[model samples]
Target: MNPFLIPRRPWTRQCMLPLGARPGLGTAAGNWQRLQEAAGGLPVPGPATLGNQPRLSGDAACCRVTPRLDRPKPLVFSAMWVWALLPILLVLWGTVGFWLVYAMAVANGSVNVTVVFPYISTCGSDPPQSCIFGQVMNVGSFLVVWISYLRFQQVRDWGCPCALNTAGLVLGLLCALGASVVANFQQNNQLETHLFGVFLAFVVGIVYFWVQAALTQQVKPRHGGGWLGPARFCLCATGTALLVAMCALHGLGLKSEAAICEWALTQSLFLLFGLFAEDFRHIESCCVRLQGRAPSPALELGAASTQTLAL
Candidate 1:
């Protein structure tokens, strides 16, 4: 009999092979069994079959794993956080200092004429009213500065080198305090105090300007014209003119109350203008950087172009 027809040792009990079985059918069967064992004893589906299929340990079904995509990190600057707190501290100092001056003025009298100088008569003989006016002006000035600094800080995204800027701001605050002290002493008819107060005010004004210029340099350019440049020029000119007028009036021995008052008002206006200019410059610079365009030179030159027209 032929080997193909003859039963082997393990297949002796079996009478016949299944359909589609070949001469090497036993070897193929052994291979299929091994493949099933590798797949965790699960039945291997034929390529022609289609339906819900169970997952196998060594099957390609688990090969559908997806990889995660990485996102870019945000850029963070160290300087921005440092400068953020400086303005808050400055505002607090200004509030406390102004309040103290007001309290002191009230304690001395209803008004404080000693602080008003030759312009004392402008507010009448009441010293309390003059003191109150001075206090109001002081508070207003502080508010303007605080607001401007905050605007600048926001636009720059850079922190003030706390050590340098804070020192300058503190010095300016001290000078303002000194001025108040002198004014109070002078009101009490203390000539020495009056002179000291005037000196302190002058010093503070100078230091304040210096600090402003230094801080302004750090502001990166933005969109729009340089509004601050012209404004700063105007302020410097006005301030110089007022300083000259004050000195000239004093030199001529003219006790003109109006002249003194004008000098004080002009000085205050100059300071306000300077502060506004610095803030505008910072904002404009920030805008320019974000938009990636240079500010128009013609627009910058023409002051009228910078003005926001009201409807």
Candidate 2:
């Protein structure tokens, strides 16, 4: 027996008497007659009456059994603010790694100061700096994957096209994997594999941003899709131009200019990811539910009979 269903005390006929029915009748015959009249006056539990009664599955019944607040307050802070930190932290990590490597290389004279403008990889290729660069990129790659998945879920929850959203998620994950490759395989050691990572991070990364831009337009968030959609598109375009310019400059024997373009392109991609904060701001809460099937008619009837007997 459920403790919640138990009564505090046994019910008596006097306590249960209907309004206007005298409970103080002296004669047994008179008392029996009054009780019979009261019972006859009560409404019968017919099909129509049962249909009008609130079932255990009704909203009122559920509310009574399981209490819940209309608006649940957060314990510390909103998760959206935490989500916004991901891109910012990722950019900061990469920037710190790049500068740290460069400063170390300059101090050690590992890179030529005059002839070649050092690319990000050039700064990381040497000892000590390489270790820091690899660690930073590996961690940043995980952050990239995390941010990408969150953004994918955000769009998916907003009812975006499944195929397009799935493609975007795949592209973003691939870009992160590429970043990991670039980090592990130093250009000085494995030039070919490092270049492949560059293609995934830059080329595939640009495509992912473009897909996200499309999704931004499709969802049209409450805050305003008008600005974010166009903004994302512009960022994607700028990244694409930078990538092309970087490749073209390298091909044309302008290694210094190419290196500059590469750096600019990388920063632009980071900025693109940070733009997800605009969408994330609108998210207040997230929910997960575990449901069980309703009781069968026979079970329901049995329960009802048991409850009646208990009463």
Candidate 3:
């Protein structure tokens, strides 16, 4: 007999056997055969049972495990969109507030070339209302322009393109400084001080052009039938014309009425131009780019097509 096939028997024949096998005993051969036959018909454990256990299948393994990462929240994009619009709102507020207060000053005879220096120098003596309004307008304009420049920088995600914008902004601040100097001059020759103010104003105009050129590159232009583009152009042009007229009238010793009227018109144009430039540029660019075809040959003036070059 093969040793592997032989069963180890430590007990008597009364011991239980597995389902498929029968225990041997001293028995009649016919009875033993009958028992063996009965056991052979029962189910037997296969090779899967010897110290082996069931395992997860491939699909079951994948489903049972948790992912290492979680899904991100959806509000991030909406928050960024709101952050982008903040600069525009600030600029509009500053422009509008400055214009309203300036117009009031002009109407009340509180604003004039002759009084420009004295008004600035002796501002503390006047009601705090006038001084505060002037300071707020000046500071607000500076803050708005700075914010606008920063916004443009973020939108482009690029290095600074030109020094012209920086120069323009700095020149504007210098113009204000110049006005202060003219006011504090020991000799109270109103004419000389007024002339200096006019000179400073002209410098401010040059600064505007530089700033506009830089901004144009950063912003888009308005589309067809939109009044914003034309309005901006008209405002800037009218302001320029008025400034020239004011200077000419002053030089030619023209009547005060003409100077006052020109000054008022210039201020109005400046306010409108500053307030709408960014919006106009954005709208115009969107329209042009959406045309489906290249812009017309006549309109293809390099960066001019997008108003980026003009500013």
Q: Which candidate number maximizes lDDT? A: 2
Regions of candidate 1 where Cα sits further than 4 Å from its true position: 1-125, 128-131, 137-167, 186-188, 222-224, 257-274, 277-311
Per-residue lDDT for 217 in model 3?
Answer: 49
* Cα lDDT tens digits for candidate 3, 1-311: 10111112221222222332322322223333443443344322322232232332221110111123343333322233343354455446545654555556555665565634222223222343345444554554454455445434433433444465556456656554543433333123355665575456455744564465445444443222355445556666666676667667757766464446454653553454355334433321211122256577677665333422110
The best candidate in terms of TM-score: 2
**Predicted structure 1, TM vs. truth:** 0.41
Per-residue lDDT for 28-67 in model 2, tens only? 2343344334334432222222233332321111001111
List per-prediction Cα lDDT, in the order shown: 0.45, 0.74, 0.43
Query: Over all chains combined, what TM-score does candidate 3 have?
Result: 0.41
> TM-score, each model?
0.41, 0.67, 0.41
Instruction: Report the C-alpha displacement of residue 225, candidate 3, in angstroms.
Output: 8.4
Candidate 1 vs candidate 2, lDDT winner: 2
Q: In model 1, what is the error at residue 135, expressed in angstroms?
A: 3.9
